[model samples]
Target: MPRRHDPERRQRIIDAAIRVVARAGIAGLSHRSVAAEADVPLGSTTYHFTTLDDLMVAALRQANEGFARVVAAHPALSDPESDLPGELARVLGAWLGGDRTGVELEYELYLAALRRPALRPVAAEWAEGVGALLAARTDPVTARALVAVLDGICLQVLLTDTPYDEAYAREVLTRLLPAPGTRDGRGPGSLPPPTAG
Candidate 1:
């Protein structure tokens, strides 16, 4: 008789690969390391991912999925006309405030893409995910720019352990937002009034 397979084993391996990268960084990741972390046979790692890049890409994609959940939960994103800065600050605070290792792991993949051209598409997908989320609340141009700024701020927080304070987030937003009553008439750079009292 054929042996029964664990239906969740594949996902568990993927989750384990992320954990290994989170704890040890990408340089330490390997099929052997991941198998040890996952407590699975080395064959399982090979069975799931034929190459290291494949494993890293899977981990990056998984991280993106988690970020998407955060974006989906933010209230301001649901209504484009609502106060964005405060809501965005709150959303970012919630995202960056927890789990430093996870944040580090994300930056690891981000930086890795710079050195490895093969990973660039995964990096672009990650950036485009944020851009699309922001576009829900603003025009594509502003969304693209804001995503870049947001990534910078996030990198700062990740590197310096800077407080993910709402005031700081608002300050950044203030610079990017258009002056009130611009000719565009609430399009693109125009933003809702500050929500913070």
Candidate 2:
């Protein structure tokens, strides 16, 4: 037999790994399972990923892009003068509203990082990426805080099966922003006390 030329084999395997995780979670992800899901020969998966961790890293990296794409589609998120909190809430709402499976799948793989050291960097990348996007409009501290709040909100909604309240999210996110004329939500905006006579 001759060798085959499948340029997309690697990507297919990654996609399959995501599907497998979505269906059976990280516990069910293996080269054999990914091969079956990808409809490729078992050897292909092994050739592309030397270990289960390698496959998981690839799948998680790809899954992290889902929310990034949603954020990218919303230009307001990057605009300094825009209602950043509202935009973030709207973007989150859009992400959570569309393709519930994808949102859940992304979180599942992301949360798996808690147990798998190999996945920690990939999970951090997601937060750093979003934080960077937000950093463009606010101080880095606030940007990071926004990411943390967003993560908490998402987990709460997913875990509790509660409907996403865009209004509440916006309010909370807005509170994270630095006060007007202040920097990093500190005392910069406060008027100094009158000097003693």
RMSD values, in order shown: 4.3, 8.3
Alpha carbon lDDT of each predicted model: 0.77, 0.84
User: Across residues 93-178, which tens digit of lDDT does each residue of candidate 1 receive?
Assistant: 77777777767887898788888777889999988878887777677887787787788888787778666656667567646654
Highest-scoring model, lDDT: 2
Give model 2's TM-score versus the native structure.
0.87
* Candidate 1: regions farther than 4 A off: 1-4, 179-197
Q: Please give me the total number of clashing residue pairs in predicted model 2.
A: 0
What TM-score should be assigned to candidate 1?
0.83
Highest TM-score against the true fold, candidate: 2
